[model samples]
Target: MASTNAPIYDELFNVLFVIGTILFIGMTALVIYSLIQFRRKPGEEGDGLPIEDNLPLEIFWTAVPAVVILFVGLYSYDIYDRMGGMQILSNDMHSHHSISSQEKVWGGIGSSKQESNTSRDFPINVELTAMQFAFLFNYPKGEIISGELHVPVGQPITMRMESKDVIHAFWVPEFRLKQDVIPGQPTILNFTPTRTGRYPIICAELCGPYHGGMRSTVVVEEPEEYDAWFKKNSKQTEVEL
Candidate 1:
């Protein structure tokens, strides 16, 4: 089975951190050196010199920030591609639908050529309805469930979320992305969860009194295991009905 690409994301983060560390060190060194060297000396009165224009220095600093901003913009875009483009929901996306305009612009940058494939083999669709505190999941079978979410591993899952009451954020930290569950209208997010484990699906947005308690679990199991679980849940649900 194909595994999750979290390590690659972590490595990218480490790279950015290295750059940040360099910036911090450079700024700190400059500040410390200036404080010690340009401090008001002993027995010295406040005889400050008039400030003059340093056009070259100003341009240098301005250009530095511009370059830094551009680099950060490009680096962030590259990371978005690594998360499997619109596959933010699951792996089987290529089999189900074509690449619509939304996927291209949803996560800041557009996807790569390899990610723009139209057809897929096994697409997973999950409809999420968010309310005051928790999210309700609706599968194609029309059964409503709560608490835990079950999905088959190594497949693309397209999550369509809508707010039942107010705005809510559907976030899975492990997935490294989130989309708001808006009111009245539906919002979509896609991802392919590679690992077969229980991942927390938290409501990152504050809704109401029980906002802090809003939580759910995402269980990623093997294909067979997922099918079995669904069958069992269906039988139990039918018995209740």
Candidate 2:
């Protein structure tokens, strides 16, 4: 469960959870108190005090939640920006900029200029294709694999993904990464795996009847081991073709 964005997402979730708990408890307490304290007298009951609206209380209730919601929205946006969500703006703004022939554009959004200039040493590039019930992964070296994605630990990996059929979603709960795979629209997700292990890749979209079965695994391995795995798979693919 080690990923660059996991902590940020966790922090956001904690904030929301705490606020929701406080609101629930406070509201419940007020409801129960009103039921007991404002209940009808034992003998007679025509009407309770002609309660008039208190401007301060009304304003407090309205303004407090409004402020809380505003704060949460801003905080969530900041966290999302830090997690590379702002890359969408970068891509959109640079959509018409000239790029090298070596660079490719998938669809709606492509890599930003800054992302295109990423060093070749790390940050391996990969393409993902989503269909009805499976994910297809293509490595930088023209190797194609299905059912699992592999990358070296501690190195950033950028995935450019699109859907082959209807809309789909790629989600890895541990990585705190989830992005829509839209038909005719390409999207990108970048993350660095900090640990070596296997984690599930789940389709978080309701695409079809078998959507629940659309699951895969991501394997993070040591650099040398990942290289070995890649070479072995590439050679096996060559033989099959």
Best by TM-score: 2
How many residue pairs clash in each candidate at the backbone level? 17, 0
lDDT of 1 by residue, 117-201 (tens): 3343234556778888888876655354645778877666666677889889987878665668888655666656678888888
lDDT of each: 0.67, 0.75
* Candidate 2 segments whose C-alpha is farther than 4 A from its true place: 89-120, 236-241
Model 2 lowest lDDT segment of ten: 107-116
lDDT of 1 at 229: 74
After superposing candidate 1 on the true structure, give the runs of residues whose Cα lies further than 4 Å from its correct spot: 1-12, 40-49, 81-121, 142-144, 235-241
* Candidate 2, backbone clash total: 0
Error of 2 at 142 (Å): 4.7
Residue 48 lDDT in candidate 1: 81
